[model samples]
Target: MGGVNCLRSLVVLAIVCLMTLFVAQRHKGLTFYKIDAPVLIAHGGGGLPEATTSNSLEALQRSKAVGFCLIEVDFDLSNDEVQLDRKMKDGSPILRDDLSNLTPMTLADLVAWMAKNPTIRIVTDTKDSNEKLIARLSQTGLKEQLIVQVYQADQYQIARNAGFDTIILTLYQSTMSDDEILEFAKANRPFAVTIPRKRATNGNLPERLHEEGVQVLINTINDVWEGKAFLKRGISGFYSDTLMPKGTSSC
Candidate 1:
């Protein structure tokens, strides 16, 4: 009787240890590029309340000051395709969101600022060719700190060819079936996939992606509750135009 009880206890202990190890392995596998789950990416540098413009250096600074380490910035080529310019000031490239603004932050200005502040990571939303954008970022020596969001497979290939460590596929179109999406994800092995807030909230895509060890991030989530809800649904992160308050833990 006593021997039988001891054997049962040993068996239970072994099962518990195995379960713990499996959970740890699963958690480690879910991390993207060493960044843990529940990332908060500030969209366009988070210029809400009408104070600053999106993609402006002021907005980026504000987001950083509010404890957001990840910021998404838009990169667009000039009309002539000569260079990547968000806005222009006297025919020179600038970072201001408003085209009519004279006091615009140039790419050089942003690079200098980033040099001073090295903790911030950038998410590049390129409106030009991936090769061009990657070349531009590489010039600043910040390519390693970037998570490039690509809309097409060719763009993804270009970024991969450029040796980008982190790439995100922005799937805004519903033209592709779920199987197609999964197959593409398997083939490309992107760090994460960005989808619409509605789809992320209502579907099992997030779970399916998690099973495949891919992270799901929702875009343009302005409401704090909505962002929390998505996180509860096992979303890896969200892009938001308004920064969450200081000390908001993703865990």
Candidate 2:
């Protein structure tokens, strides 16, 4: 009789374990990138050595040769119009770009370029991405490759409402506490968080983010050691612009 009772208890334990696994998977929403190590995401248009990048054919060739799988670029709306307005550190504005020029790009033009480059994925910053522009992008061939990112929570809601399943955004610098960040990350369950390396708060913060189903990607890492440090702290990836590190390789 005791043996039969033990077998029944074992069956109950197994059922509980499977249920726990199901809940864990539902909560974690973290999709493994299948990409290991830190990914080198090209900043700007990967263009000229000067201030503003080319965003031209040259940028595409350069990034591909360097083995960069991700390209991060700016996409803004005019606020008054659906036309794009982007700003680069070089002081060039996308609005100022000539319609026939190759130096800069507009959002509509950006989508056209993405369709041309099917090999690389893009993380587009929607600083001013508006309803009309987003609707247009949703109809583009490159919509699947774009990650709609915004710093504002309202924008997050907008993207979600627009049927964007993946979002790359950051915690507010001023008001977000670690506890709150963790709760929000898990609750909303974005694909990833793109934040400056300096703003990660601490090692624990990233782990918490991960626990909440958000992968932390530290941005603008040119130094190799800093990249390694983030890796040690459990960050999923980083935004880098240099060549491969002397030692380690892919994740």
Candidate 3:
């Protein structure tokens, strides 16, 4: 009976190994052009000294002058229009802040800006209105320039169907286990995965994703040395507020 039980265990282990191999082989999802895109994403348009306000036109201009082609912007629905809005630490809305006295920027305004700057690709970070934003941007013939970030797995298909070829499955809003996350990346094949800094450093998640040919991006990094540390660990890049490549400056 002991011999029989041992034989069963061996068979089970073999089956599991085969299953793992099968899954790894299927990780090649559709490759978008941005897979080998820039290594640094200007967080909230970057250039802190020049552009004190994030998600503003001035911030974007400063970021562009800093030689960044990739910029991450937060979105929110306001007055039945998409606006560049990110809440402050004290929970005050960016547009309504008495201090900044900034004007609200609508989607139409952004589209015009995008048309002028042909090389810049916008990475969206919309909390709940990604579907609306994707549809709206797609209609404007900017589908190729938009890298939509989806919070859920099903949203990936939705974004793809909306004419977006590049999609990023950000892990900040997901509750999936590490193994499950890896499986999702292998199966769906998003252009990249955005991970919180803490989670990126926790385990071999970044390495595993790289093995599957999925690029990994860490969020909200500011220091130059910290970004280098993550890059050393095989992290593809960072969503940084101020960090930029060497010899590139807002000045």
Q: Tens digit of lDDT per residue, candidate 3, span 65-120?
A: 76778888878764555677744334334554532744445677778988998788
1-251, model 1: which lDDT tens digit per residue?
99999999999999999999999885442211112335778776665445333566667777777677778877666663332236455787654343344334556776777777778777887656667777677667777667888876667787877778799988774456667678888887898888887777678887787788888889877666676677777788888765364454331
Candidate 1 Cα lDDT to native: 0.70
- Clash counts for all predictions: 0, 2, 0
TM-score for each candidate, following the candidate numbering:
0.73, 0.65, 0.76
Give the clashing pairs for model 3: none
Error of 3 at 211 (Å): 1.6
Query: Over the stretch 1-251, how does candidate 2's per-residue lDDT look in tens digits?
Result: 99999999999999999999998885553221212465556665442333233455455555665566677665555434332334443444443443224445555566677676676677764444345555656666566687776565556777777767767765433266667666767778777776676677444778777666678887666566677777887787776554332333231
Candidate 3: count of backbone clashes, pairs at least 3 residues apart or interchain: 0
Residue 213, candidate 2: Cα error in Å is 4.7
User: In order, what lDDT does every prediction score?
Assistant: 0.70, 0.60, 0.74
Candidate 2: C-alpha RMSD after superposition: 19.9
Model 1 poorest 10 in a row by lDDT: 28-37
For model 3, where is the 10-residue window of minimal lDDT? 28-37
lDDT of 3 at 212: 89
